[model samples]
Target: MDGLQAYGAGKAGGAFDPVTFFQQPHAILRIINWLFSVVIFGCIANEGYINRPTEEQEYCIFNQNANACNYAVFMGCVCFLCCSGLLALDVRFPQISGVKDRKKAVLADLGVSAFWAFMWFVGFCFLANQWQASKPEDNPLKEGGDAARAAITFSFFSIFSWGAQSFLAFQRYKLGADTAIFGDYADPGQEADQGPYSAFPGETVESPPAGGVDGTAGSPVGYQRQEY
Candidate 1:
């Protein structure tokens, strides 16, 4: 079966194919997420701070709100790490022998991806608002403005990418759930050997008495002999 159809099936110990792995929709989204994270955090870390000749220490570029810059950086860094870990897990997913484990992994991916998507939405809004409120005097040379815009733009993109990841993970979860439900049903062919009371094949059945209930030879129950 194709890899997408085989998702969550937990068919283990298959040969690893790098080309196919990279070509998967899931893998492509993850790579996009990873790159977006790098862009967000890299921009903030490199150019989020600016200083004037009169200032002794660097101040954040987004209206001098350290919290805004910190929040973006934190989210970006954590997302970067999560994408990396998930990519590694994806590489090893085919080797997992347990369906439950694969299900758990997919569920985790769903939850984490959804949560990050929301967070990136918040980050985008927060950064954009702060950038708009920034005073021109705060950045005399207009330094890091492009970086700020890049961070905001990529944060916006990350929301959709992560959301897409969540959607894909949910699909995998559903596939696994369906597989588990169908697997629990006894096969029709296999049920032929199981009797109504679940009696197994070759089981001995008790036989009734050969004669009447009274053990009389050729005598019926209602015909009792009279004393003559």
Candidate 2:
């Protein structure tokens, strides 16, 4: 079955729909992140070249802060690819069957999500702070000022986008934690056993007979009682 049926994601048809795809929060965030990545990458890349002066020094040399902005662009590209891969995975394998494996996946997602959030926050701050701090003596008219500002603005947007993803991952982690504590979350690959709770709909424990084989009280007729 497809992911929608496998995971019971929705009641609609299992077939893919563009409108439904964009409706989900995770998918929305992924698309937004992807767009932000592209925008930031373009701005930073453009700024790096556009701001370069024709004089003795290059653009980066003219604006030392541009280096940090370039690094942000690199990270944006990486985040973009990561977002794409995650989106594809979500669409293809929406639900993981095994409990243990699912928990591991959730934890990994949480870690990666948090890492990206921190990276984006720090990157945005670093770029913005560096840009604002640097005061160049040469006041070039077309020093990619607009591109740099756009990159910084989109960098901020990316921070929130990644933060939202991280928050969602954390919520998933919390749900997994609750399931581990009180529910029957088991790995299908492992041998099944009676967990801490009884089977659903209730179960009954069979009681042995009161009489014993030796005419003693409280012993069953299955075998001789141990003296130890």
Candidate 3:
């Protein structure tokens, strides 16, 4: 509840503080994701290339085949950029602070999170499969083998990381929904702008008269007047 209140306050034009931002679990996870993606990108782009098969074996071969490595590098770059952008937005914009904005942000996060999870799963599988299929016969020695393996491993790890993010996003989305309809995280008396019975602004409510219906100053309780 405190978290939700803080989030609402932040959305309502509260000053954004870096210390508070980093305290959130989501921020930590995103930072880790971005750093891991950068590592994977470096490995695949720098050390995951191999010589391409040609009719004549040249002493110095300029051709290279990096099919699986290419895909991994692409995924890494995309994920890295996305995570960085999200981090910046969290600090500057933080649309998730408000209930309505939170719903939209959660939906966007769900789609992006699911997409990244699938991409990571596919990337690791393809890289591993290609690495296995390209095994050499006698005295097998592969170039960039360590980097390729590392990239594949990180890709696999990213699947669960992204899945966990999706789970958190889904929970936040539900919270947004509940807040919209039932004021779940709001204060006890005030309903945080939800529900039908809202206290409107500047609308005055009149109190009942001190005198009874018959204008008697000291009318007893439940007194009734008889008409002729």
Candidate 4:
């Protein structure tokens, strides 16, 4: 039963272990996701805008498409925040005693991870397309080319990392479901009620007849005739 306990069903107030926590596959992926989001948003925020000598206003470097740059930056920021929140939740997960609560948490993780993964995919494609279509004349100096490429690369990596998180969450959900089902079926109260050798209720064993061998209240017929 110890081996079969559902994830996040551990006793509360356990001591935290940083080494073990970071060693987990899911934790490692989360850290990677966090880093990727930082790289994407950091690059775009700092170097995504450029100003032409002729124009007074700054413009987005991705083909001058503000939407492209905005989309990537927005998604990246959201991912970074979400990763931080999820990491905190992961740290507290094992202390959750309620199965339903744990389930809700895992489901939230799954949905969020999946949603972010899709968003990153979209952002990567949008940014890359805009970059590819950019005219050399727009920025002849190529000031933010490296930054734009870095953002796009990290966005692409983020898609896979978030997808992996979703997969891990799904696995945890399934494991918990299986453990709950088996636990219900193995309940001691149910087993006691259905004991193998127990008789049905209200049934009684029959007693032998009170009188003679012929099953009558009087003496045997042969013995009575001899006395007479």
TM-score of decoy 2 = 0.70
What digit string (tens of lDDT, one per residue) describes model 4 on residues 1-228? Answer: 333356544555566788988999889998999999888888899999998887879899999999988887888898889999999998988777667778899999999999999988888899999999999999977888999999999888888988999999999989888878876466688556655544566443333345755667765433444464
lDDT of 2 at 83: 89
Error of 2 at 10 (Å): 8.1
- Summed over model 1, clashes come to 0
Cα lDDT tens digits for candidate 1, 1-228: 223234553358888899989999999999999999999999999999999988789989999999999998898899899999999999988987766677788888899999999999999999999999999989989999999999999999998999999999999988777766675566787566454445456563333345756898776545678999
Candidate 1 structure lDDT:
0.86
* Residue 189 local lDDT, model 3: 57
Global lDDT of each candidate: 0.86, 0.67, 0.68, 0.84
Superposed Cα RMSD, model 4: 8.2
- Which candidate achieves the best lDDT against the true structure? 1
Instruction: State the weakest 10-residue window (summed lDDT) of model 4.
Output: 201-210
lDDT by residue for model 3 (172-227), tens: 67766665655554465544334444456544333335786667876644578679
Task: Output the lDDT of residue 7, model 1.
Answer: 50
